[model samples]
Each structure stands twice: as structure tokens, then as C-alpha cells.
Target: MLLREIQDEILRLKQEKDIAILAHSYQSHEITEVADFVGDSYALAKKAMTLTQKTVILCGVRFMAETVKILSPEKTVYLANSSAGCPMAEQFNKTDIENLRAKHPDYTVVAYINTTAELKTVCDVCVTSSCAEQVIRSMPQDKIIFVPDINLGTYCKNLVPEKDFILLDGGCPIHASMTENDVFKVKKQYPSAVFLAHPECKAEVTKQADYTGSTTGIMEYAIKSDKKEFIIGTENSIVEHLKYKCPDKKFFPLSNNFICGDMAITSVFDILDCINGKGEEIKIDEDTRIAAKKCIDKMIEYGG
Candidate 1:
């Protein structure tokens, strides 16, 4: 089938099935075009709770679908592709955090929202990239453990230097692959362009950036800034996304290596199959769901 035909079908079927489709910014432009909402994973999860639809189709990864299920336990959630899991989310198990907790009982466990359901259960609070600095600064504890993303932890650490943070050496390999050399090279290529870097990249990379932010942050910075050109430091898809949204603006990739193979796993065809009720159901037991939700609830309670 053609692109338009598939999109029309997705629109028709999702409405017919009482399903809300949520796409992440990292997803392809074609998928985002047919989605009911497109943003970051946690933002999409929060959006899922507000919709009247009973079913939600997550066009992201396993952990994202799990988050949708975590926030809206009553709603039925499906992952567009079952095998599309996040390497960063799965890097550390619950036991790893448990052991860390045992070692440092007084330290607050601050979890990145990209973590697994089980990992969140033992966490004191949760934070998105956009809110990590604020949330961490709000905490009363002097010591904390930020999990799964060393780059993000470092980003947060630099911003909130008053508190002590213990970071595990685990993060998105795709973003971690970027280096300060990439930024300098891209800057040389586009001397006047504003460089927007994601927090997932190394501190060296983000430090050289003109602006450091989340995926949504990067997009908004590019669109709202007066600068007519930008080198997006996140996923390569943001370039296409921003180009489509702002025709007058010029967007370029910081490097060709910024592409994420996992995010690209869910093609329009996968969404088509999902609309046909062929996707995997994200099932978290009630106990884990309830326990996992407390930290997310704390995040919302803390002004996320």
C-alpha cells in the first residue's frame, strides 16, 4: 500500500477501535504524521492518561509502552513492535539498584524515566531530562544515585552541583557515540548555526553545544529561536521533523552516526499491523505497577 493509503487506514482504524496513537519525536516523519500525539516518551505517557480512548498504541520502544501502562494502568497499552526495546532501560536490573540502595541507605535513589518498571519500584523519585535539574535541586537529601545514563547524570550534576550524585556507567550507546570532535567539526561546517544537543550525549559534547536539552527541548529551541539554522544533536529524525514544521529554518544532523536503530524499528507497516490488533500487549503485574507508579506520582507531585 501507498503511504497515504496506510495513513488513512491508520486514522480510520484507530478511531474505529477507540485507540489513541502516541508517537515519540525520534520516530519517523511518516509515523508522526499519522499519530494522534508526538513528543517525548514520558510526555506521551502523561498524554495517554488524559485521552478518552481505552487503548493506546505506543510507537516508541518497550520501556515507553511500559511507562504508558505505568501511568494509566486502566488503559490497555500496546507496543507497535515487541522487539523494539531500549538498551539503556535494560542495562541495569532492579537488583543492581537494590544493592546500591543497601550500600548507601541515606542516599536518595533518583531514577530517570527511561528505566524499567521494576527499577522504579525501588526508586525515591523519577525525573525526565527536562526536569532532572529542578527535581534534583528540590530534594532535601545531599546525596543521590542517578541511574542508567551517565551522560544525563553528568548533565544534571553540572547544573545542580550542590548535591552529590553517584552515576552508573550505562546510557544510550547511540547518543554516547557522539563526541566533542563531532560538535567542532559540525560547527566548522555550519559556523553560524545554533547547536542543540540532547542531555544523553557526553558532557564534553553537550558542553560545546549552544543549547542543551531533551528531544522536545531541542525541537522547541530550534523552532522558537531567531536563528535560521541549527545542528540538531539528538536523533537524526529531528532534522526531518523540524524541517517539516519550519520550512524557513535549515536543520542539519550533528553527525550521521546519531541515528537510532531501535527507534527506527517501528515502520508505518508495524503501525498498520498494530491497528489490526497484532502488536504485543505490555503487561506489568498489579504490584509492580502500583509500586512503580509512586515515583512517577512523586514526579508529578514535584511539578513535572
Candidate 2:
């Protein structure tokens, strides 16, 4: 079947079956085009809670699907493609943080929302790339242990200097793959373009960027800016997404290697398989679910 035909059928079946599709910003345009909602992982999870559908298909990755289930425990959630997994999300296990927590007994443990549900159970609060700085600033603790993404932890540390942060040697390989050399090379090519980077990038890369933010923030900045050209420092898919959203504006990738194989693995066919009951269901034990939600709830409270 053609892409449009698959999308049309997905639209029909989702409505007929009372299922909502949540697509991450990193997902392909074809998947997002047919999704009921499209946004960042944390935002998509929050969206799932407000959705009236009893079932949800997340066309992102394992951690993202788990987040939706964490927020909306009553709703049945499925990861469209079971193999779609984030390297950063699975970078560290429970023991790693547990060891850190054991060492820093008085420090608040902050878990980035990209983490797995099991990891969040031991966290004090949760944060997204957009809200990490704000949430950390709002936190009463003088010390914080930011985990599984040292690049983002470094980004937050720069913004909220009052708190002491313990950053682990972990991060999104795809985002960290982008270096300052990529920025300089891209800038040499597009001297007039503004560089907008995701916080997941290495500090050296983000330091050179005109703006550093989440994927949604980067998109919003590109859309609102009067500037005609932008160099996106996140996933390469954002270039395609921006081109479709702002045809008048030109978008360029900071590096061709910024592509995420995990996000790319999910396709519209997976959504079709999901609607036909072939996708992997996201299931969390009651104990883990409740334990995991406290940190997310803290995120809303602090980030709000």
C-alpha cells in the first residue's frame, strides 16, 4: 500500500477502535502526519493523559511508550515497534543510580524523562530538556544528582549555578555525536544561519549555538524567528519536519550523522500492525508504575 493509503487506513481504524496515536518529534513525517498528537516524549506522555481514547499507540520508542503508560495507567499503551529503543534511556540501570544515591545521601536525584520506568522509581523528580533548568532551579535541594545524560546535566548546570550537580558520564550518542567542528563547518557553509541546538548536545556544541533548547523549543524558535535560515543541531528528521512546517524558511542539518536509527526504526506499518493487535503492549507492575509517577508528578509541580 502507498503511504497515504496506509495513513488513511490508520486514521479510520484508530477512530473505529478508540485508539490514539502519539508520535514523537523525532518520528518520520509520514508517522506524525497520521498521529493524533505529535510532540516531545514528555509532552506526548502528558497528551496521552488528556486523551479520551482507551488505548494508545506510541510511534516513538520503548521509553516513550513507557512514559505514556506511567502517566495514564488506566489506558492501554503499545510501542508500535518493539525494537525501537533509545540508547540514552537504557544507558544506565537501577544499580548505577542506586550507587550514586548511596554516595550522595543528601542530594536530590533528578531523572531525565528519557529514562526507563524502572529507573524513575528511585528518582526524586523528573525533567525534560526544556524544563530541566527551571525545575532544577525550583528544587529546594542544594545538591542534585542528574543522571544518564551528562550533556543535558551540563546544560542545566550552566543555567542553574546555585545548585551543586553531580553529572554522570552518560548521554544520547546521537546528539553527543555532533561536535563543535560540525557547528564550525556548518557555520562556514551558512554564515548567515542561526544555529539552534538541543540540550542533549555536548556543551562545546551547544555553547556555539545561538539557542539551546528541547526539540519542541527548537522548532518553535525556528518558526517564530524572522530569520530565513537555521542550522538544526538535533536529529536530522527535524530538518524535514521544519521544511514541511515552514516552507518559506530554510533548514539545514548540523551533521548528517545526527540521524537516530532507533527513531527511524518505527514506521507507519508498525502503527497498522498495532491497530491489528500485533504491536508490543507496554506493561508496568502496579508498584513500579506508582513509584515512577511520583517523580513525573514532581516535574509538573516544579516545571509548571
Candidate 3:
């Protein structure tokens, strides 16, 4: 079957089944094209809450689908590709964070939105890559314990230098793998292009970027900027998406290794299968959901 045929079927079935589809920015263009909304995980989750559909499908990873369930508990949420799971999200578990909390009793616990919903239950606040700096700065605490993604934690810590941050050894393997040399090579290849990186990247990599932001933030910046060329430092898919969005502008990947295998695993077929009731349904206990929501609610309060 053709790609468009499957997507058309998915569109027809989702409407027939009263389902809303949320595709993350990292998802394939075909999946995003058919989605009701396409953006980052937290934004997608918030969008789900405003949606009228009783059921939703997230064409992303497991934790992203879990976030949707946490936000809109009344709606049924499914991960379009059951095996698509973010390695960074699973890097730190509930117990690991609990142990850190025990050691830093006076510190505020900030969980990145990429974390498992279970981990958020123990967190004081949640933040996305776009709002981490602002959220951390807004906190009244003098010290903070950031979990799961040390790279993002470091990036935020640098932005809000007044607060003491305890960063552990955890991050997106794909982003962490990039080095200063990779940035230099890319910059050399495209001297005229501005470099935009995601905060999940290593400090060395992010420091070299002309702009560091969330996936959506990077896209918006590139679209609005007058620059004719850009080297996207996150997932390779962004380069492709940007090319389609701004045909006149040239987009290059900072490194071919920037491709996320987890995000790549999902396809339009997964969304079709999900809408047909063949995907993994995300489930969380009432207590866990409520507890996890507090952190996210705090994010909205502080980020706003």
C-alpha cells in the first residue's frame, strides 16, 4: 500500500473512532502530516487536554504517551509504536531519584518532562528544554537536584548560575555522543549557516551553537529568522522538515549520528494500527497521575 493511502485510512478511522492524534516533532513527516497536532511532548499533552476526542494516539515514545495520560486522565492514550521508548527517559527510575532526594533534602527536585510519569510523582516541578532555564530561575530554592538528563541540567544551571545544581551522569545517548569536534566540522562545512542545538546535547556541543532550545523552539527560530542557512543540531529529521517548511533556506544536520533510533522506529503504519486498537495503551494509577500532575502544573505556573 502507498504511504498516502495508509495516512488517508488513518485520518478516516481516527475521525470515525473519535480519536485525536498527537505527533512529536521528532516523528516522521508523514505521521506529522496526518496528526491533529504536532509539537513537543509537553505541548502535545497540553493540546490533548484541550481536545474533544475521548481517545488519543501519540506518535512518539512511551514517556510522551505517558505524559498525555497524566495530563488528560479522562482520555485513553496509546503509544502508536509500542516499542518506541526514549532511552534518556528510562535512564533514571523512581528509586534513583528518591535516593538523590534523600541526599539533597533541602534541594528542589526538578524533573525534565522527558521522564517517566512515575518519576514526576517525586518531583517538585517539571520543565521542558525550552523552559528549564526560566523555571529553574523562578524557583525560590537556592539549590536544585536535576534528574535524568545531566546535559540539559548543565545547560540550565549555566543560564541560572545563582542556584546550585546537582547533575548526575545521565542523558540522551544520541545527543551526548556529539562532541566539540563535530560542531567544528559542521561549522567549517557551512560557515554561513547558523547553528541551532537542543539543550539535551553535551555542554561542549550546545556551547558552540548560535542558539540552543527545545525542538519546537529551534524550528520556530529558524522559520522566523532571516538566515538563509542553518545547521540543526538535534534529530536529523528536523533538517528534512525544515527543508520542506522553508524551501528557499538550506538546512544541514550537524552530524549524521544525530538521528534518534527510538523516534525513527515509529511509522504511519503504527498510527493506523493504534487507531485500529492494536497499540499499547498507556495506563497509570490515580495516585501516580495526580502526583505527577503537580509538577507539570507547577511548570505552567512558573513558565507562564
TM-score of each: 0.98, 0.98, 0.98
Q: Give one digit per residue, the lDDT tens place, for model 3 in 183-295.
A: 89989999999999999999999889999999999999999999999999999989988999999999999888888989999988888888889888999999999999999
In candidate 2, residue 77 scores what lDDT? 93
The TM-score of candidate 2 is 0.98
**Cα lDDT tens digits for candidate 1, 9-104:** 899898888889999999998999999999998999989989999989999988899999998989989899898989999999989999999999
Q: What is the C-alpha local distance difference test score of each model?
A: 0.91, 0.93, 0.91
Candidate 2 achieves a global lDDT of 0.93
Residue ranges of candidate 3 with Cα displaced over 4 Å: none
The worst-scoring run of ten residues by lDDT in candidate 3 lies at: 295-304
